[model samples]
Target: MLNIVLFGPPGAGKGTQSQKLIARYNLVHLSTGDLLRAQIAQGTELGLRAKKLMDEGLLVPDEVVIGMINSALNDNKQAAGFIFDGFPRTVPQAESLDALLAQHDTKVSCMVALEVAEEELVTRLLERGKTSGRPDDQNEEKIRKRVTVYNTETAQVAGYYAQQQKFHALNGIGAIDSIFAQICGIIDQHQPATSESSRQATDEVKA
Candidate 1:
């Protein structure tokens, strides 16, 4: 399976690219925000706990988030792969993710970092604020805080993956198609080859 981690600051088109990758590669898309919302909507115990933190405008605790991810992985194990978005925003979470995947006898195939100019991100975010009515986008102070927090917390996670030789950096400042093409290129180069012969061999063993 071609597990991929999409890493970048807010407004870097991480969600957009993840959607595209999911469609093209038949990957299970796991966005932490989506997971939390689904859990809260289902009114699960973890959901209720996370909701309290979110209601208080605090980040969800790592254990809660990682537990949610583990459940998602189990549910989606039949998928050909997974594209992770908006989780692992800290080194500890990244390390935990490594441990989780290791237990499944798989690991992250790649971590793609979206590189964009700060001014461009800020400008795009300001425009999105008016259009999307997202509170985090509406205030410059909050937007800056979000970006700063991303840098301080998540940026170092890239180094962690880099040491594992699974890091790939791509320019985020480009036409959407161009950026996507670059990402697809990386995917093509790294995905494992699982030919029909291999499939038949595995099936024979199961039989």
Candidate 2:
């Protein structure tokens, strides 16, 4: 399975790029934020706990998020691969994800990080807030705080992946298509080659 960890600070275009990557690669989009929202929507036990924390302006526990991810993995057994967005925010979380993927005999093929300037991120987020109506995005102070938190906490996860030689960073500036093409180039480099027989077998199955 071609698992990818799409890493970046908030407003770095992860959501937009993840959608494009999913469409192009046939990968399941496993976004922890989306998963938590779904859980809350369903009023699941985990979701209720997460909701309470979120309501209190606190982050959900890593275990709860991992449980949701585990469920998603189980639910998509037939998926060609998975694109993980807004997840594994800390080193511990990244370690947990590695262990979890190991259970399925798969591993993170790469971590693609979008490197954007903080000023650009703030601008993008403020513009997004105009329509998104997300209070956090509307406030410059909060936006900067979020960026600081990512730099101090989540950015360390990049080093973890780098140690494993699976981290790729790209400039997240310019047209969306151009950035996506660069990302695709990175993913293509890491993508495993399928033998002709395996390709034929997959085609036959599709047929």
Candidate 3:
């Protein structure tokens, strides 16, 4: 399983790059934002709670998000792997995720973080806000707060993966395809021939 965590700040083009990655890697896309939105659309209790916290510029409880991830993992037993987006926003969440994956005898193959300048992100988000229709994106104050929250709180997740030597940082200030090529290069290096052959051997053994 080639599980990948696509890490980036708001408006860092994660959504854009994710499309290409999914096509190339055949990875299931597990996006917390999408999961929350579905829960909200269904008027579920969890969704209502998430909305309140989100409206207040606060994070949803870790347990809620983790449960969603757990469910997704269980449902995709035959998945080649998953591309996790907009998740594990805290060190504790990352820790919980590590434990969760371990239970399934798999682990994060790599964490690919897109490094973008704060100002560039701010500008990009504000421009996106013009048509995004999300109230939070429309407000510069909220956007800055969100960015600050990520920097102060969520940024620690990177160090967690870095310690394991699974963190890959890509410069996110270039043309879209160029940036994706860089990402592909990193993933290719991470999962070299030996890893693929090993996975094939493991599959044969399981069979």
TM values, all candidates:
0.84, 0.87, 0.90
Cα lDDT tens digits for candidate 3, 60-89: 899989999999999999998889988889
**Superposed model 2: Cα runs more than 4 Å off:** 41-58, 194-207
**Deviation from native of the Cα of residue 180 in model 2, angstroms:** 0.7
* CA lDDT, candidate 3, residue 114: 92
Tell me the spans in candidate 1 whose CA falls farther than 4 Å from its real position: 39-58, 194-207
Candidate 2 lDDT over 65-162, as tens digits, reads 88888989999999888999988899999999999999988999999999999999999999998997556768888788888878998999999999
Model 1 TM-score relative to the real fold? 0.84
Output the worst ten-in-a-row residue range by lDDT, candidate 3.
198-207
The lDDT for every candidate, in the order shown, is 0.81, 0.85, 0.85
Q: Which whole-number lDDT from 0 to 100 does residue 161 have in model 3?
A: 96
The numbered model that scores best in TM-score is 3
Candidate 2 lowest-lDDT run of ten: 198-207
Clashing pairs in 3: none
How far off is residue 21 in model 1, in Å?
0.5
lDDT score, candidate 2: 0.85
User: What lDDT would candidate 3 get against the real structure?
Assistant: 0.85
